[model samples]
Target: MIESTTVLVVGGGATGTGIARDLSLRGVDVTLVDRDGLSSGTSGRSHGLLHSGARYAESDRVGAEECIEENTVLRSIAGECIRDTGGLFVQLEEDDPEYFEEKRAACEAIGIETALLDADEARERVPDLTPDVERAMWVPDGAIYPSRLGAANAADAEEHGGTIYPHAPLEAVSVVDGRITEATLGGTVERTIEPEHVVNAAGAWAGQVAALAGVEVTMAPSRGVMVSVAYDELDPVLNRCRDPADGDIVVPHADEAVLGTTSVPVSDPDDYEKAAWEVETSIEECAKLLPPVADAPTVREWWGVRPLYAPDEAEGDRRGISRGYFVLDHADDGVENVTSIVGGKLTTYRQMAETTADHVCESLGVDADCETATRKLPGADDADRLDELVDRYDGQGPTDKDVIAQ
Candidate 1:
């Protein structure tokens, strides 16, 4: 059968859902499709760090700036999806004091709030922290729930008249005379979709999706492995005060503390191999930050592939690539009405979507300003609603009935 829409968004990760919500709010007929469910890729596999941009302040100033901006925005609009637990970057006795000073200076230059904490204060905050820690710097980082954030975006999109189809993978792109006309989606339910525009937000698999449309996009898929421990040893996100490297961060997610990760370039997005060394290295390295984690029970482990973008001229390895995203107009490559966005982290998905949506709207002559920044997603006001529920329940714990209303 044949379906039609004003826009077809491939890849139902954070970026794609954000775009669908943005375009739909602007009165566009949008359809989003994904090979798996929302956040089934890198989005769900991440350490869920809602970055304060402090991590990249020195290495990638632009990326750090973007992260800090988006971090504030997400905290405002997506409060329910965030834990708001602050982060700490600790300097061990052997680490570089000069680099620690540089990180603080860079963070201050970018307007990211930084507070230095002495060893006693740092250890008081995180009792499990290694005794050898020299000092610490606090940043406004938080833990984010990927599933909740993506679901909120998807829900808001649907409320605004957008359609989402999970498990529908794009099999082929039907292009004629250098313009995209339709896309073939293959799954249990097959259909050909004729879209006025196609957006590739396929995350790590963006390169493969672009190839289906006969356009070449170079994407370096870097795999990172995360190991989950059974206990939440620290309330704040912990980071090693050094350059970006494997297993430098430990994020507290719900009751578990997630220790991660290793960045190794890979050829396939689906090649999520959990090497024994990677897991061992993560525990050993993260143990330097929190000693309890070394002996904690490892409950689970998984791997995520980052959609690193390095054009031919761009230098350095995957770690050196900027976390900033790219919105490629295939028209520049001789394919019309198709745009592919890649290379951003979850913290800046909304901004990435806004940028891509702006380009798409301009190309189609749609005159609508982006309202996603200020608009609240579905259930975003649930905290207020929960307060009302509390009053209705006379300050007692909410019963199943009251919870259902929310």
Candidate 2:
């Protein structure tokens, strides 16, 4: 039996769910497939710091602007899923002050407010901050959640009447006469999925997915390792006040804190192992910014792969490549009746969805515009009110406390 749909979103992370929700709300038939549970990839393993665009200020202006814009949008819609703990960037005495100054000015020009805080005041808020830290710039848009963006997007897609297939991997892209027709399930799951517009939102696995389609997607895949700590509050999210390198960020999640991460290009994404030297190196490095982190309880360690896309040879400067999105019309590239959305951040999933949906609609000749922006996702409306309740309540039972809280 061949089932057909308007689109196939090929990842279970923030991006795929967001695209499914967007297309479904536009009155399009959409199916979302994933190789594992929701957020099974880099989305679940991230540092959980909602970017304020400050991280990209010195290096990538376009990426910075997109982050700032999406940061505002997600905060407005996914308020309950977020904790507005705010963010701080600390520059150590040994770190270059000029780069810090450049980041501050770039943020200012891009509408990301950067407030310089006194070292003592910074210490007062984040007591663990190293005394050697000479400067701090606070950005107000920082948010942290126990889990990242997957939940909200998943809930939204389901409520919009979209079908979500977890644990289904794409074995191959089935195309006929230079147009994509469908994708076969990778493993024998006793069921198959046939989607019209197949989206390759597979983060680190994007290049592999493209390979199945007989195309090439070149993303600079980099691996990052993170160390998790139990208990102890750190103010908002603490960043190294420089472009993201290794062990430069401390993101507080739930009752615990996570100190991360080291970035280096890798040939494989599933290489999840901790080098004693690497964790020790991270702890030592984090200690430079936050003295106690050198001694902070080391509860757990994990790694993630970020899908960094370089400009196509057919394209020009990578800096000019829009951070917004790349909606490849499969028809224009040899394959017809298919589209792929790839390379963006979890913070900007909504905008990415809108762009992809517009392109899909154009391909399918649909007239309706996307309504994902206006609708409140399921449980999202309950997010703000259910915060403390869900924190204390069990994941299983129903209680009046939950009802009254919402």
Candidate 3:
């Protein structure tokens, strides 16, 4: 038997779930499918930093602007999935001062609020910070629970009458007359879906999905590794003030701190290998920020492949590629009724979804303004109300972490 829906969304990460929720909220019949569980790919493995746009402020102005805008929106509507720990960009004695000035200028240009902190003030907030740190800049960065965020979007999508299918990998995409008519499911469960529209939100694997439809989409799949230390010394996110590079970010989570990541191009997203040297390098580099990290026990280590996209002729290292995303309408490539959204960071997932959904709605002649930007997600209501609840309970009630985890 074959099931039918108005839209079939492939991929179950944050972007995919965000798209599902947005479309369903607009009264569209949507079905979201994933090869594994929700957030089983890059979304689940991210370091979960809610970027304040400082990291890319100097290197990529557009990315920085998008991040800051999305950061404000997410914090307002997805408070339940984020911990407002703030963030700091520390510059050590050996780091370049001129670049720090440039970063500050860029932040200012992009409307990201930043406060310069002298070494003493920075150390006072994070005593574990290396004494060699010359100064720091404070931003509104925070830690997020990507899995919970994705789950919340999925829950809201389901509540709005959308169907979600996990562990359902696409086997074959049947296109007739330059349009997608049906898609077959493979793996443990077998089924078929026919939809008027198809959206590929497969993240790093989006290129592969487009190929299944007999079209080509070039994507640079870059792998990054992150290590989790058993100690939690910093309350705010720590970043080295400089251009984008590996081992420059450290995030404090529930009870531990996570140090990461290295960007290197890879051919196969699922076949890349994680080296021990990468793990050692991340620890050694992060230790420069927090001295205690040099000897801290590493409890876990993992890696995620970024679905980085560039034009076919674009050339450079993976890090040089823009963090911005693209929404491809296959009609331009002579194929109709299908679109693919790729690239961008977890911090801007909602905006990416809204943009893609707007295109989808336009194609289907459905007129609906996006409500996700203002609508409260499943567990996220009013930020002030949540804080009041926390204050009323204090040490006498379940912590915010416990509530979010549930």
Candidate 4:
């Protein structure tokens, strides 16, 4: 037997759920499916930093501006899913002072809001900070709990008459005359779905998913390791005030700090080398910023794959790739009814969804405005309720497993 829906969204990460919720709120019938569960992909495996735009202020002006705009929006609507712990870009004595100055100036130019702090002030704020901390710049960065965020979006989507199926993976797709007519899914949803429109929000696996429809969407995935260590006193997110490098970010949790990560290109997101050096290097580098983390016992470790889009299979370091997102209207690739959204950070997921939903609306000629920016996610103000939503949707991820209810 075959089921039908107005839209079938592939991938149940933050972007997928956000898109479903946005469209459903706009009165569109939607069905969302994931291979495992909500946020079981990159969304659930990130360092969980709510970007303040300061990280990219020095290099990508447009991306940084988008981040700050969305950052403020999420803080307003996400509620308990975010920790308003603020953030600091710490510069060590051995680090380049000119780079730190450039970042600070860039933040000011981009209106991200910043405050320069001396070594004494920095130490006072985070006493565990290394003695080499020459100075620091405080930004509005915070920690985000992706499990709650994804589950909340899914719950909101379902409430608006959308269907969500976890543990349902898209196994086959049939295209007829430049349109995806039906999709055969495996796992719990062992049947075929006839969707008027299909959205591939598969993140790192976007390229592979697009191929199923005879369309090409290039992806350059990279693996990074995040090691959560036992610690309790850190109050703010710590960032290395240098260029974007491995172990440059440390996100605080309830009783641990997630030290991360190293970027190494991989041909396939699912198959990659999980090297011990990456873990060792992350700890060694992050320990420079917070001395106590050097000896802190390791609680857990996991790896996440970045969904980096490569048009020409770009060369050089993978970190040079932009963190911005792309909403591909696959009509250009001869698949009119299918669209793929890829290559974005978790911080800007809602905006990514809004944009994709706008594109989908245009294709379907549905006149609806996106309200996700203003509509607070279901259970946004209650942590326990959010965790229940997570449990209901199986949206728990390693990044927030410690913070959320056990």
Give the top-scoring candidate (TM-score). 4
RMSD of 3: 5.0
Q: State each model's C-alpha RMSD to the native.
A: 5.7, 5.2, 5.0, 0.8
Task: Name the weakest run of 10 consecutive residues (lDDT summed) in model 4.
Answer: 308-317
Q: Model 4, range 146-193, lDDT digits (tens) per residue?
A: 999999999999999999998999999999988999999999979999
The digit string of per-residue lDDT tens for model 2 on 172-250 reads 7677777677677753343555666677888877878877877777765666677776646676788897655678877
Kindly report which residue stretches of model 1 are placed more than 4 angstroms away from their true locations once superposed. 313-316, 381-406
Query: Can you tell me which runs of candidate 3 are displaced by over 4 Å?
Result: 313-316, 381-406
Write candidate 3's Cα lDDT for 1-406 as tens digits: 6999999999988899899999999999999888877777888777888999999998889999999999999988897678899999999999999999999999998899999999999999899999998999999999877766777788788889998876789889888899989999875458899999999999989989999999888898888888888786679999998777878899988767888889878888889888888898889998888878878887778888888888663345778888899999999886799999999999999999999999999999999889999998876654444433323212111112323333
Q: Model 1 over residues 1-406: C-alpha lDDT tens digits?
A: 9988999999877899899999999999999988766667788778788999999999999999999999999988986667789999999999999999999999999999999999999999998899999999999999876666776787778888998886688999889999889899887448999999999999989989999989988988788888888785579999999988889999886668889889887888886566799999999999988989999998778788888888762334678777889999999899989999999999999999999999999988999999999987777767554334223212221111122233
* Regions of candidate 2 where Cα sits further than 4 Å from its true position: 146-148, 186-189, 271-274, 311-325, 381-406
Give the whole-model CA lDDT for all candidates, comma-separated: 0.84, 0.69, 0.85, 0.94
* Candidate 1 weakest ten by summed lDDT: 393-402
Ranking by TM-score: 4, 3, 1, 2
Give the Å error, residue 303, model 2.
0.5
Please tell me which predicted candidate would have the highest lDDT against the true structure. Answer: 4
Better of 1 and 4 by lDDT: 4
